[model samples]
Target chain A: MTDQPWIAVDAMGGDEGLEVMLAGVARARRRFEGLHFYLVGDEARIRAGLHSHPNLSANSEIVHAPEVVGSSEKPSQAIRRSKVTSMGIAIDLVKQGRAAAMVSSGNTGALMAMAKLSLRMLPGIDRPALAAPLPTLGDNDVVMLDLGANTEVDARNLVQFAVMGAAYARVILDLDRPRVALLNIGSEDQKGTDWIREAAAELRAATHLPLDFTGFVEGDKLARGHVDVIVCDGFAGNIALKTAEGTARFVGDLLKRAFTSSVRSKLGFLISRPATQLLRDHLDPNNHNGAVFLGLKGIVMKSHGGANELGVATAIANAAKMARADLTRRIAEDLGLEHVA
Target chain B: MTDQPWIAVDAMGGDEGLEVMLAGVARARRRFEGLHFYLVGDEARIRAGLHSHPNLSANSEIVHAPEVVGSSEKPSQAIRRSKVTSMGIAIDLVKQGRAAAMVSSGNTGALMAMAKLSLRMLPGIDRPALAAPLPTLGDNDVVMLDLGANTEVDARNLVQFAVMGAAYARVILDLDRPRVALLNIGSEDQKGTDWIREAAAELRAATHLPLDFTGFVEGDKLARGHVDVIVCDGFAGNIALKTAEGTARFVGDLLKRAFTSSVRSKLGFLISRPATQLLRDHLDPNNHNGAVFLGLKGIVMKSHGGANELGVATAIANAAKMARADLTRRIAEDLGLEHVA
Candidate 1:
């Protein structure tokens, strides 16, 4: 493994300001020995945050990007004109091999666009998909993909997604012959759209691939951890992902309100503190941290836009792990993209 | 209000057997005054269960249907051949005005197919849709439609769903101008498919409709109760509905595991039973018991195939409320379908 420890972070991204990003970087650096950071954003704002942490400031480098890509800006426009934006420069560092990988908590569309445009897709890859780790009942978490990358796709694209996702499962989660499935309306072969039916056939026919190609999986099977990699078009995937997140929040809030409703419940909650902590850790979005933009030639992880210090720190750690694992190279080799011109 | 209190129920439908159905019907009769039921199913099984429940036997009548439709059977095939199937006869009773409404806990596709073939769509209604009440954060619930009725729909069908959903919301939730929203990938007007875009434009231009047409609501807003009526194609809506249900179960199960991980935690959980019960009641799928097949000429409520006594009782109550409010007639009038012929 490479000894390089610095992570290029787009400090100007996310809904929060430089304070949270810088704090996250500081926290990560403090926790991990010899960890360094390249904070890409406005020099003035970053410096203001670093002033409180002398040790973090000593270990960190600030790269000034004159423009910041706003979350509301169109992705294509942001990619074209905002060359000096923090996110753009952060991806540039990764592309130029100055940084191992890049992490951004910005507009997901823009981040995906910039990362793809800057590093380019791996050989034989038609599109780059996003995969996030979802907590499951099983020993390991599940990997769900194409959360919001390509809205409309054909059978061939879905097959390719399965290939890439299988490679991801192997490299990221260390699963052998990862059980891969296509997200459909039902579990049967002929349940979904014609495209899905055709794709299911294609997935079944791929004998040479090193994947346990399971049959179709419905949305209900997602949290059940039946399949390792769940693939679908970005539209359905986005809905499922956001819905899960929202439901988790809703249920968590409901439990909190329930606990505080009465004195007896409050005492019970206090007694269950250890269990509650474990539960919170398991459901915490920060633990999942990063969603990798797969099929790209380089590593780029997108943190949730509303992520806090802990979330950002976890994202930085995720990017570092991907870099050490050389995830892109492994994906290329596994997908036979290495032979492609 | 019509004093005729009998509801024609399909006993041979659902995953559960005739005993469960009889139990549910018995519970419904005991809960509601002046309630009568026409249980249509296999003669022997229905009578066997009714024989045990003497009180239910007095108020209930069994319509002997020799054949039963399997949950996996094709809807068209089931409807074409099994004329005397429990579900078909239940719809027929409603068609002949023997019962105010029909309730089934069967294959949704079969129910919709039989209802469409027997009851026919209301005038000016292109297609019938399924509307299910989703519990929201607010005091009132949101009615989401096209749950799994029409797999493919045109812009006009969505417009019709909006009208029907708004009418149901008005009568059920008692909202004057029920806020209607087209479920889209994004809140923007041009975000989704061509059909959704066209539907949004038409809904925006509509002046005679009795609704506060919200432009769009994303999947996350469904739980937040941001809109009263959420409209979408059957495929996406089904995926969303199933996903929410699965996630709710996943979270609930996860909490249970967390609480039972240790003896101390179990004790804490025991003490907090009241709060847990409250949360469970709030998130119970049975609480929102029935999915109404809207835009049909008469009322039809589809209960969960796995629902127990409480769920069936709730479905009966929901059907009774719809019948008393004359929900189908109101929807027809609002859509100007009553005079279309």
Candidate 2:
């Protein structure tokens, strides 16, 4: 890993504003010695947050950007107009080699837009995808890709997603030839639409790849951890992710009610507190903090916009890990982006 | 509510054979007093099984159905060729008023086909939909419709599902003007396709209907009980239902492992037995048994083919309730089927 201390953070982004982002950066810096943050946001607010923490202030630098991109702003328009926006500046730092990687907890669309525009797509990639490691029933998590990044995708795009996702699993999760599967209604070879079927055929025929390309996987297998990488178009992936999140929330809420129902039950819950905490930690979304926008030339991690300090810290760690792993070099080499238009 | 002592069951249907079905029937009969069963299957085998239980033999009748409908067989062809098939014969009994309502834990495709072909669709109904009550966060359950019965749907069909679902809720759950919402990706007024948007408009303008008629609801809201009736096309509804089931199973398996991780945790789990049981009962798919294929002239309930005896009993009770409530009449009146076609 490079001894470069600074990482660029989009401070003006996210629902919680600069305070949460700055707080997360401060926490990450405290945990990692020699880690410095180039906090990109309005100078006044970033300084206000840094004023309280002398240790964090000593290592951090604030880069002033006049305009802030609103969450609702069109990604393309924001990228073109707001060069001085915190998110835009963060991406620019990566492009200029001022920072090893960039972190954003902002409008996902804007982050992808700026990342692509500034750093450019890796050689053979047609489109970049957002990949998140989701907690499964098994000991390890599965890497699922294109979670609301591209709404409409073709067969070729899905295959590309699989390749990138496999690479991500290897570099980030330390998997060897990560088993990849396409998400579908059923596991049958001919279960999905023409695009999915065609993609399955292509994935099967390609023997030159470094990954273990398994055929189709049903939604039920998602949490089973039957495969290391689950590839799909954004629409389906988004639905699956949100459905899982909703189910988790529902189950958690139900458990809470059950535990608090009666005096005896409450006592029982107190005794089983450790077991319950283990389950909660395993399922906690915050623990699985960062989503990497793959197929880009530079590392760009998108934390959940509503994530608290711990979540942001996790995202920072993820960004640092991705940078340390030399993710961009691996992608450019494996995907053979040099031959692309 | 009928004084009829025996209900005819299609024993030859379902993935589990006559033995399991007979076992379920015997269990239900023992628990529900005055409940006798007309076991429709190979009479020789039914008699052989009943040899040990003289009471079951005396109380139950075996209608010999020489043929069985395979799960993979085309529904139309099965209904056409197999007049003596258990599912076909079961529906025939209901049609001839020999039984109050027929129960089938069999090939869903065949049951739906025979029900539509033999019992026929309720007057003015364009297509029949399968509606099931799903347990939600609130005290009551949400009624979701068209769970894989009809793939291609129009705006008018969705409106019809809302009506059917609402009527089912009133008849079964005894809810007044149960809030109905069209399931879509977003709750915005103009989010979905033209068909869904137009349907939303119609639902909003439906003043004469006995429904609260809440606008659009997202997938997450299904568990939150924000709305009582969730109407969607069969494809989307099927996906959502399966996803929920898969997720619930995944989480349940994870919790089991977590609770049994260590001796201390296991002891704590034993102490929390009642609370755990309550949680299990609340989330049990068996308790929420029987998906009724609504909009048909005769009551037809499809229990999960893999369901055990308790599931079959729940399905039988569901059919009995539908028969008692005369769901067909209410559905016909609610949809204004007489005026439609």
Give the best candidate by TM-score: 1
For model 1, residues B1-341, the per-residue Cα lDDT tens digits are: 48546799998788777777778888877777677888898888887778767878778788888787788888888888557688888899899888889898988878888899889988888888999899878788989999878767889899999989999999999999898998877776547778889988888878568888889887777888778999998877887888888888888998898899999999999888899899999999888889999988899999999988778878988898888889988997888831332
Candidate DockQ values, in order, are 0.67, 0.43
TM-score of chain A of each: 0.94, 0.95
Model 1 chain A: worst 10 consecutive residues (lDDT sum):
A332-341
* Model 1 lDDT tens row, A212-287: 8898887777889888999898888887887787788778888998999999999899888899899898888987
Model 1 scores a C-alpha lDDT of: 0.85
lDDT score at residue B12, model 1, on the 0-100 scale = 79
Number of the top-ranking candidate, with lDDT as the measure: 1
Q: In model 2, what lDDT does residue B255 have?
A: 76
Q: Please give the lDDT score at residue B323 for candidate 2.
A: 73
**Model 2 segments more than 4 A misplaced:** A1-6, A72-81, A95-97, A109-127, A332-341, B1-8, B27-38, B51-60, B72-81, B91-101, B109-128, B150-157, B186-198, B337-341
Cand 2, B chain, TM: 0.93
Q: If you superpose only chain B onto the true chain B, what TM-score does each candidate give? A: 0.95, 0.93
